[model samples]
Target: MITVKAPGKLYIAGEYAVLEPGHPALVVALDRFITVSITETQDQGTINSRQYLETNFHWRRRGDQMIFDNRDNPYHYILEAIRVVEALALEMGHTLRVFDLDINSQLEDQGGRKYGLGSSAAVTVATVKALIEFYQLPLNRLDIFKLAAIAHFNVQGNGSLGDIAASVFGGWIAFSTFDKDWLRTVLKNNTFSEIIASDWPGLKIELLRVPSELELLIGWTGSPASTSHLVDRITIAKFAQKQQYQNFLESSRRCVETMIKGIKAAEVNVIKDGIRLNRQLIKQLGVFSQVDIETPELAELCQIAEDYGGAAKSSGAGGGDCGIVLTDHSVDQARLISAWNQHQITTLPLTVFELTGANV
Candidate 1:
């Protein structure tokens, strides 16, 4: 059996601007993950499937049709992931038969759907890795990236791609599309290796999961916003010479630099300031209507977090989804949780984890 576990990601900086041609972004891999395990079946050439195993969830391929039991709607993400693997197998002129695949994902904080955490990208990464191992395909990280990109495009049209790259590579990365082809050149020329081999100290990161004593409240705006729609709107606005948007990007870039410095220096106050500044910059984008963030519920929650001495911001593509909040003080956490309870917002505990490559 081959198992692949891919971590989800959080964009610490360069959220929407990363999609621009010359902008760079930084991201961190979270402990939240999507894991896939696959093994060959006795019926080497035929496909059969099962769902929700007594011991573990099961999925089997029978001929061209893949079947599995539906335990939840979130499994739709898993189904989408399988489709990508199936397509890749066909491209390789090989068919996988009697394969038992199990998918397990952990991202409850987003209530199963969050933007900034890269849940889809994580699934894509794990699915691609499982397929590569199952077919014994001779593909490297770049090859996996290409496949994951295809899946991401299919799921979320014109995805930022930064999330997938972060999930696949892990650690803090300064990614730029400045030259468009620069990334490919760097990979081919071993630029990453050269940088790692140097004597420079690696970046420092703190993974703060929501403490059990505190509640990380997340409220969804009833309206579902398409990431593609927002991206298109921003693109058109940028093309039309929207000075505010440009200023937002520039400010975001500066915030990114400050964040890097804060992380390096281990200054909690600087980190807090950077978070607040970044939130203000995102608010300037004017993507959220009627609310400074996304949903009124989320905005209210942010207020509660702020009252508790924490900071809150929208997690992803922004029309509506989850909000991320960070707080370490216990008294503040108690007040935050009380506020969330009064408002009836769902809360979860989140922790920051070290960013590591997806090899398991």
Candidate 2:
């Protein structure tokens, strides 16, 4: 059997603004991961997972296309990964074979509740990694990232694709989005192979260095929010209030740039200040959009962390889900965790997933 793993991610700063091309966001890969394993099969192939209510999916091949026994399925990203990789394989004159794919995830609770840890993106990347390895394809991490991004874009159809980059290149990264319109034009004019090889305008991913004096903490508010739904709501508000939206974007850009500089220079104060400012900006955005980006639980999460001398804010789209905190080593982490526990907030024991030689 062939196995591959991709790590989950959390957004440190620049959430809604990063959707615009060239806007930057800071994201970090977590220790948690989604693992995909594959074994060759002669006839029908199966997919099994403990994460879903319907745990088994059977499929047969019709040429290069997969015909699943049940159309209503939860493997949209996984299936898309297989389709695109198979297309690439066939384009390279490689024959296809059947395989049983197994998925295991650590990005959720035992009840299968997601922690807003980028599970979909990790699974997609893991599936692409597994198939490329299974076929012995000559592709690097960047190639896998591009393939997974394409599949994810096809399904979600929005967002910065920063999570995909974090999963591909582990650890801290400053990510800038690509021009979605340009990508659409390229897809229309070129073949899949050519599209993969072409440059994506305005997209950039640079790894970051964390200061030794800094400590990161995560708190999950027992509620999960649909990122897509939140984004869609914010988009409607953006068009209605164009000037306010533009101002928000400009402010977010400056804040993220400041944070990046701090990380690069190992200046803990600058980084923490940037986080606090970003949190206020997001709260203002919620007010103007009339959408509660930061719920009551998330507000309490941030307030408690701040009381303990940490800079805290909602991560990602943040209707609910996880909130991140940045603090110096001198702060009382034990007290902060205790405070969170009293408020029914679960403190996740997640650390930064440093990129090693073994990670792709």
Return the top candidate by lDDT. 2
Tens digit of per-residue lDDT, candidate 2, span 55-167: 34557799999986432234888899999898888887899999999999998898777899998889889999999999888888788888888888877777789999999
lDDT string for model 1 (1-360, tens) is 888888876665566877765555656666677777887777553222222121223355999987653322234445665676665566667776667777776743323344345656777788778877888877766566556655565555554677777677665555543232443354356433242233322222223322234323344334344455567666666766577777877888788667666666665566566667777777767553222335576677667777778867766566665566655543356666777778776564444444434343
User: Which residue window of length 10 is worst by lDDT in model 1?
Assistant: 47-56
Residue 195, model 2: Cα distance from true site in angstroms = 1.2
TM-score of each: 0.67, 0.94
- Model 2: colliding residue pairs: none
Scored against the true structure, residue 145 in model 1 reaches a CA lDDT of 59
Candidate 2, residue 151: lDDT: 83
> How many angstroms is residue 36 displaced in model 2 relative to the true structure, after the best TM-score fit?
0.1
